[model samples]
Target: MVFLAPKKNLFNLYFLRYKFIFLTIGLLFVYILLNGDIRSNINVRKCFSDINVQNKIEDILLSERKPRKGKTIFFHETSCNIPDTLNHVRLKARQACAIESAALTNPNLDIYVLFASPKILNNQTITPILESILSYPNVYLRNVNLWSYAADTPIYEWFKDGKLFKSKYIYSHVSDFLRYLTLWHWGGTYLDLDVVMMKTIENIPPNFAGAESIYHVAAGVLNFDWDGFGHEIADMCLRNFQTHFDGYDWGKNGPGVITRTLHEICKTKQIYLMTRSRCFNFNVFQNETFYAVPYTHWKYFFDSDYLERTLEMTKNSIAIHVWNRYSSDTPIIVGSNVAYGVIAEKFCPKVYKSSGKYF
Candidate 1:
């Protein structure tokens, strides 16, 4: 009986051990299925990073309940191929002038320009732009060294389809630009040089955070809530850029990475996407108000006249943005008649002279 009992006891112990092993294996498989390998998936990683940043930016904004009274800072960075001479200077100057005029109309607000470190040229033009900004107490210039964080070679060169992709400098420029904002403005509006500030933006809603609510606002006409999610988004973008540095060269892949990141981060926090009414209209002028248009709607961007008509009809627009077509020298013209032409002339008279003048 004693020998038989020992054998039975051994059998029970082995059976229990096998059961436990199976249970552990089953749990592990479930975890893998549920969570997956997020880091390995570029899209997943991008989304994760974006959500992380949005939360951080929201935390910052929520902490500062009061409206920031400091000067509105307009920021920009120049890369190697961008012209620093006559044409480029004129375009940049026009943008600055438009913003400065808007600021002058509103005495309570000041506009300042922070010139990021010039990669293509020496610091010579920086002085002139600074001097020009000096005319107004609110308008000023500050230089930032973004190259410190940038990899020695462009991120695209490290990837396979780098040749097809553009905006390689976006990640690096945005990082340095935000860093300067933190140091100088702490919590202020950061306007893109290509954007034209149409109206005074003295009281941006605390929840709005200056980013376009409906469609994502272009980084160009961003309003940093200092307490908002700009920093977090910027940080996540940088990290993702480093991780999927090779994948960025795919056409639209880089921005796609950014968009995914923004959406994911915003979703996790339950931070509602900013609606068009909450922030400025992202694109299109309809019913006399700037409306948010999706990025995919680029095909509808007929020309400057079409944009101008849209602007004229828009009721409340914080700013008008001219993105994507930044590299083209000619005025963006679209449409096909006197009715459209009249509206276009109201905003941009020069469009009348373009090849598509009839349209």
Candidate 2:
């Protein structure tokens, strides 16, 4: 007797036919979810300079015309070995204060603090210190990873082809590179975790960077729009980074990258660097207004003299980078005489009160 084939429902028929294909897809989905985007692998090496993050900001400078209204950004690169441990609590809190201060002073601006890893955001309960920062109405948080910071831009593939940070160099260099890429992707201010806003940044230009000295432009406080100098400068800087890199010199990738790129850009512009008032596609802020505290004396921010000399500097300064490199282990005591303690109480009173530690 011949047996007849059973009629099957459409769903069952399709499922039987595509079972192997569906299994393969399901496995891939699980792999991606468990491992994250392949583009994010740190070793997926790319030269810092040559990677194309996005457009050259200079070409779009004035042509870009205007920036999206109200934008400021901060990057917290915890992945580069910077953990939120007790030893680092005050410094992290101070960084949070800087962001909150900016948000409070400039209510019109949309301030963002991008955490490089989900470690902090993933925590079920963030430390009380972080509470002060999260309380701000204007401050917002984003979870960015290695891939998100530089991926899907003009140079995502190029970067993935080459190695990024070196094992020998301090991981902060990784942060330095990410800041440049993030700024290139989205033109806006990029603040180091060390900064503290003293006043409203109402004067920040559409495409602008601040100078730490006549020869060096500090990347600590930088801003730009996608179509303007921000992109142009970052693109050129990344290229220079590929050609001239010194892992031993920490600044080589940070301030040095921008300073070296400025020379190349200025040469093309054929404008004299005299008077230090040189104009580019966007704008350049001078040292007097930007670098109120020179690198040599960054430690003063933790001393008592800050009440006098430091405040004097802020007269023309937009913010201060307390140089936490020298003070990461330092604590900000309540009702203490330290400069950082004073600044903390003034800018992040809530955090200071939450500390509940007399020491």
Candidate 3:
């Protein structure tokens, strides 16, 4: 017993010799925990020789929240309903400009362009426009099938040509479904092929959708994360997509779903101010900063008289939706003094170069 007591005393004495060092380390850890500056003071030493203090400190710092590194990314995708006629849907220079504008404006984002069609892949043709988009390091093009996006859901087979009622807008409906699936599962920004980015997308919190008009939240620009209310909204929309789906109605799948979901989330049918964005879970923007020119005024993009006015309006907007459906048939004159020409020249010089004077 006497020998054991002496040995214990000897061990205590050994530890007491570095008591000041141990106390200093404890204080340092407390300071690090309190102060959010995790990037500083990485050379601190620990009293114990076996401890890898730096790695332990890193783990602790990362445990607070998901460590988000690098510039924020916006996810985008497009679907060609008639995959058999992929050549008709090959990426055009204007569409390429939409992607280029996104990458050029943000510079940090990795824009993902998912092509949702099986038949398109069978006979692949890379147009000059697609070649230009492929050159960007940050832009990625991928294949995403309908079953791949909504395979497990109830409305999985609804995408089949013969399964649903025939309509001219079936392709558009499928696009809406794909956007929901993409944002729900992947969780990032979704831009229409017609939209062009004008400014950096920053400061906005996650899980947000925007309204182009009163009670009309368009799915063209949807930004969300995989966590929190994003997944919930997606789940709600997908489930309802199974229940209240209509192939005959044009807006039923796109804007209609958004309006219905908004009502479900807010628990009201009253005309709420979209500008205020007082939803319970996430926010919805109606302010023109999100979409300067509404889809109805899409022709203004190609009109020479509205060129000066459009340019003035675009300064405040983060992006402009060109409403390709309305303006797709119109030719873009590179130097004939139009808003589209001016926008193309400034935002995407490469695309403009291809268009030249008469395209």
TM-score of each: 0.47, 0.70, 0.70
- Report model 1's TM-score to 2 decimal places: 0.47
- The candidate that achieves the highest lDDT relative to the unseen native structure: 3
Cα RMSD, model 1: 15.3
**What TM-score would candidate 2 get against the native?**
0.70
- Given candidate 2, what's the lDDT at residue 311? 66
Give lDDT: candidate 2, residue 191. 79
Candidate 2, residues 1-359: lDDT per residue as tens digits? Answer: 99766666766878887997999999999998757534334432321221222221111122333223326565554443223221211225566677777777777766766544333332445677677777787666654455545666655664565445442453666777667776776666777777777677766556666778766778887766765556777677666765565657777878887677766666532212522345465555676555677878876766775667776766677677777667777665678776667766777677667766631
What does the lDDT read for residue 124 in candidate 2? 41
Rank candidates by lDDT, best first.
3, 2, 1
Off by over 4 Å in 1: 1-71, 81-91, 105-110, 118-133, 147-185, 206-217, 227-258, 268-308, 324-327, 331-359
**Weakest lDDT window of 10 consecutive positions for candidate 2:** 52-61
lDDT of each: 0.40, 0.61, 0.63
In the range 1-359, model 3's lDDT, one tens digit per residue, is: 35456888988988987897899999999898756333221111011112222212111112343212223343334443321222223666677788888877866666766554421322245555666666777766555544444666545665443333233464576567777776666666777878777787755666676677765777778776666777677777776665677767777777777778878777665434432355655777654766678887888888999988888877777778888787888997668788877877778766667654554
Better by lDDT, candidate 2 or 1: 2
